[model samples]
Target: MDINRVSARNVHQAHYELIVIGSGFGSTFFLDEALKHITGRALVIEWGDYQPWAWQVEAQSNSPIAPESTYKNSGNKPWNTTIALGGGTNCWYAQTPRLHPNDFKTRALYGVGHDWPLGYDDLEPYYCRAEQIMSISGDPDIGKVLPRSQPYPQPPHKGTSVDALMKAAMPDHHFICPTARPRMATANRSACCANARCSQCPVNAKFTAENGFPSLFSHPKVDVCLKSEVRTLEYSGNQISGATIASEGGEYKVFGDVFVLGANAIQSPAILLRSDIDYGQTGRGLHEQVGANVEVFLEGLKSLDGSTITTGYNYYFADGDFRRNRASCLVSFENRWWPFGLRKERGRWDEMLSLSVVVEDLPNPDNRVTIDPQSGQAVVDYRGESSYAKAGIEHVFDNLDKLLAPLPVESINSRIWRPTESHVQGTLRMGIKDDGSVIDQNMLHHRMRNLVVVGTSSFPSCSPAAPSLTAAALSIRAAELLYS
Candidate 1:
């Protein structure tokens, strides 16, 4: 607790064997595994204070700092995030899906982007470990595509009638999406009650860092400081000395043998840029999936039998030869959501289904994160959305009619662009070359081996599925590879 006191009156200087910034999935999972191999003291610096689940539900807010205040955007679209102690874990939908095997070899397979330094097999065991810790709910058959090493902890959540139709038509492509929202009641969490609201789960069913990963903070060798903003890494040449932190009492520097930056894609790169640690396009190539929502009207089917808020994933468009010409998308079947429409025609009010297509984008350096001269906060200039992703959307438009032909006769209806998937990636990609990437496959900084950057910021490519599970898996792998 004395390390948290940042004033001239405090005579003792703060130092630790390990210093970790941010407490999201990347930080928590990495720490969860790293501490197993490490016996030294670790300090976690969190920018925002923790809010209880009840407070979050009543306030209808995840963090005291709204996402809009954290960054200055050049475009109308915004990046959604929770800036509290738990980070985005306080406000995620809990949809967990693994990246397709082909996603790792984009350059080798489709000649679009650089290949990931590592492959699915390297992270498969860690994926199983992360899934077990989260008690993920998923069907075993998904292994047909993802090649899982272990079965999910809980059985899959049931799908809606519409999902059944798609799975029946495309058996290999459609399956229940793995989710952190428990299917069976646990001592710490209740089973998901089809609450329909996921971001701010009204029932507190989703696995949040506060509830799911509480031990990471309470570990005997660990201590956490809230409301402590880390400004930059204090390093000389290739050695990391510590970090400069700004707190209410005063500004001071803290020392550590190792530093792990687990902040989000936007903030992590900003921290690196502020520290003057530019290696391999440090603040460039920032992106996420560009998604579009579609509605389907069925003549005879009645919807709403799904067991969770989001039920199934359609991977038919996620990978294939199409990547040689255009980008691909991952289709998600939205279930039990309120915003999905109802028909006005007599006796046909409940025959509609809502679907969303998430398209992966090729990273563009022109679309980047920079520092605002005045505010010093991150300034996101996102003018260049990949044309490949747009082309993928166009391809979907051309083939959706035929793809949905298996379902009952009705209209394909309208499509609306989603403002943000809230999944910021890239900026500090991992690869074998320091000239093109900031970190290596093990997540060690290309310049400073002691400085490890964990999280989606190290993602080499944008996968259409949510990156939380993958990020967590990568964290576990990084810890075992380095410390074990």
Candidate 2:
């Protein structure tokens, strides 16, 4: 696709009811819900192309394609989210886990992050709605754990050699069972038709923002500007007027009645910083929970030699630290290394299935994100620890080490790596008061009335489980705030 740019004035002088920025999961879910209530002209601006890029194919060549059909991030250019259509849903692991109610009330019960503005009960309907949209599949009855939605769209895929081996080795530690239902990829249909390890869904099984959002573009009222980038927000008075856009064709401006920032956690904060919009705590005190993988290769146990490795036991998800429990340290006997070589590490097919490891990370403010003056990009620096994260780490490795203790692949090695945040939250956090947060409980920007933020960034503290399901759920609630 060719790049083009237009002025905000030319694009929206007539005024659009809403303009959604970034086409990731947050925008997709929210926009879909918004259309249900507010019927007006909408505009969606995306920087990346809607189609798959060269890098995605390149990455797949390196590994057995991820069965869950997740977006493969190749650190080639600026982070790519689907710009042409579906956003990152074009590729995202379909693992959907809800926030245990304990996680939402953490701040009130435990002194971790602030308690969520809304509780699990308030968001339950949205969770149900999101589940239907994503077509989730899982067994929610794991003893005391509450299942957020109904049974997944499909039964959990069969476990692989690693799954069987872990069960044989340890009956004590329990890993959280992942849902096998398809992630919502498109709106009309909710499930994907693909293999367990298939990362790219063949039948729109997984729902991505693109799947839901393109409908908005098709609406006579909504106009989607592809490859158009928002560089700044043009505000007048307390309300937002429009936005300034930059693209290959140059600079332009766009006008909208309301502005919605769904640019993911990192980019949203970065955009605010670049726009010279500071809510005082805008970029300060950012938190990205860091994680590390610990590998255990069983001695004399060549049981891991298999083509399709699926099914996992994710024990150690809950050590009962409610405040920090949102950041569950997961231990799974799945493929150890990401199919593709991480960083600069070179690998072959054999390297992809070499061993399996579990990861535990602490949510630290030190491991936060800040703007770099030199490069002017958001940079992450992770360095924080919690007793729960540390304990979770220890528990996972201990369990793994014990399981493989008597096997030929006996050596157990644990190394700490810099944290990678999945359930990224808290940049534009919710709080009881204005000074304490970027947005109020309603997800509306505290300072800006016409702006709302949706996604993990709104999370004050990430829970221990998968945030995608919850993120989808909350955004549905956010859409309700606008539509309902």
CA RMSD of all predictions:
2.2, 6.6
What tens digits encode model 1's per-residue C-alpha lDDT throughout 1-484? 0223223223125788888899898998988888887878888888788787888988888887988888888998788877887888888899889888989999899999778999999989999999988889997878888998789999999888888888889889889888999899777788998877777788778888877875678788887877777888888889888887777767767788889998788888888888888888888889998988888888899877788988888878878888977887888887853455568889988788788888899988888899876656888999867789999987887788766766885887778888888998898889997558889999999998899999898988888889999999999999888886
Off by over 4 Å in 2: 1-12, 52-85, 160-176, 179-205, 210-216, 297-310, 313-317, 321-327, 335-391, 399-424
Clashing pairs counted in every model: 0, 58
Positional deviation of residue 277's Cα in model 2 after best superposition, in angstroms: 3.1
lDDT per residue for candidate 2 within 246-284, as digits (tens), equals 766677777778788987676677777777776746644
Error of 2 at 424 (Å): 4.1
lDDT of the structure predicted as candidate 1:
0.84
**Cα lDDT for residue 173, candidate 2:** 47
Please give the TM-score that candidate 1 achieves against the real structure.
0.96
Tell me the spans in candidate 1 whose CA falls farther than 4 Å from its real position.
1-12
lDDT, model 2: 0.57
Tell me each candidate's TM-score: 0.96, 0.76
